[model samples]
Target: MLDINNILIFFSIYMNKTCKKLISCYNIFFTEQGVRHEFR
Candidate 1:
């Protein structure tokens, strides 16, 4: 049986890691777009 507390902890950790990665990716994508706009 899975413990509810353990599941919550694991989910939180997973979400934190994914959130950081997503934020970095979003930043990179926006930066690229901004640079392209400036060049045009």
Candidate 2:
């Protein structure tokens, strides 16, 4: 039972890390697009 809980915790942490990276990438993309749109 303890081993199962440890595995779950590891998976959750890995997911959270990936989500943060994706959000950062999206933010950079949108910021660039917004600037171009405003100029046009």
Candidate of highest TM-score? 2
Per-prediction TM-score: 0.79, 0.85
Local error of candidate 2 at residue 30 (angstroms): 0.7
lDDT of 2 by residue, 1-40 (tens): 9999999999999999999999999999999999999999
Query: What lDDT score belongs to each candidate, Candidate 1 first?
Result: 0.97, 0.98
Candidate 1 accuracy as lDDT: 0.97
Model 2 RMSD in Å is: 0.8
- Tell me the tens digit of each residue's lDDT in model 1 across 1-40: 4699899999999999999999999999999999999999
Residue pairs with colliding backbones in model 1 are none
TM-score of 1: 0.79
